[model samples]
Target: MILIIAKALVKDESLELFKREALELVKNSRGEDGCIEYSVYEDQEKSSVMTFVEKWEDRAAIEKHEGTEFFKEKIGRLISYSENIEITLNSEVL
Candidate 1:
């Protein structure tokens, strides 16, 4: 299994635009074959931060997702509007 946590810290003024782009991507991503789970989350204390939490069957699943046009375009737009963004990947310890 593969787990990914992608976080974007949007500028205060760009939050709405980020939300629109992100939600669209989320809706599409959920239907993918290897997508166990995909969703957007917001920081409770920091309203400007948006997080995408994803679970996939394996690395191939994630790579397929990254290759999609929708993911590329949406992520590019989000990155442009964000102050900072980072992704973390994890695998089961056992």
Candidate 2:
């Protein structure tokens, strides 16, 4: 399995727009073939920070997800709103 954690720090003025697009991305990604789980959360302490936590069947599954139109149209817009972004990937140690 593959696990991913992504964090985005959105500009204050762009929060509403970012949330709208992100919601659409999450709703669609959860329905993908190899998506075991997918979710996005806003940090109460840091209002402009949003985190995405995902679990996929494997690396290939994640790669396919990255190529989807939802990724291009919705997630792609998020970069413009974010001041900074970070991502972490993990798998069980063999």
- lDDT at position 87, candidate 1: 94
lDDT, model 1: 0.93
The sequence of per-residue lDDT tens digits that candidate 2 reaches over residues 7-80 is: 99999999999999988888999999899999999999998999999999998999999998779877779999
Candidate 2, residue 39: the lDDT equals 93
Q: List, residue by residue over 1-94, the lDDT tens digit for candidate 1.
A: 9989999889999999999999999999999989999999999999899999999999999999999998899889999989999999999899
Residue pairs in candidate 1 whose N, alpha carbon or C atoms collide under 3 angstroms: none
**Model 1: per-residue Cα lDDT at residue 27:** 96
- C-alpha-based local distance difference test score of model 2: 0.93
lDDT scores of the candidates, listed in order: 0.93, 0.93
| Backbone clashes (count) for model 2 | 0
**TM-score of each candidate structure, all chains considered together:** 0.96, 0.94
Candidate 1: list runs displaced more than 4 Å. none
In model 2, which runs have C-alpha deviations exceeding 4 angstroms? none
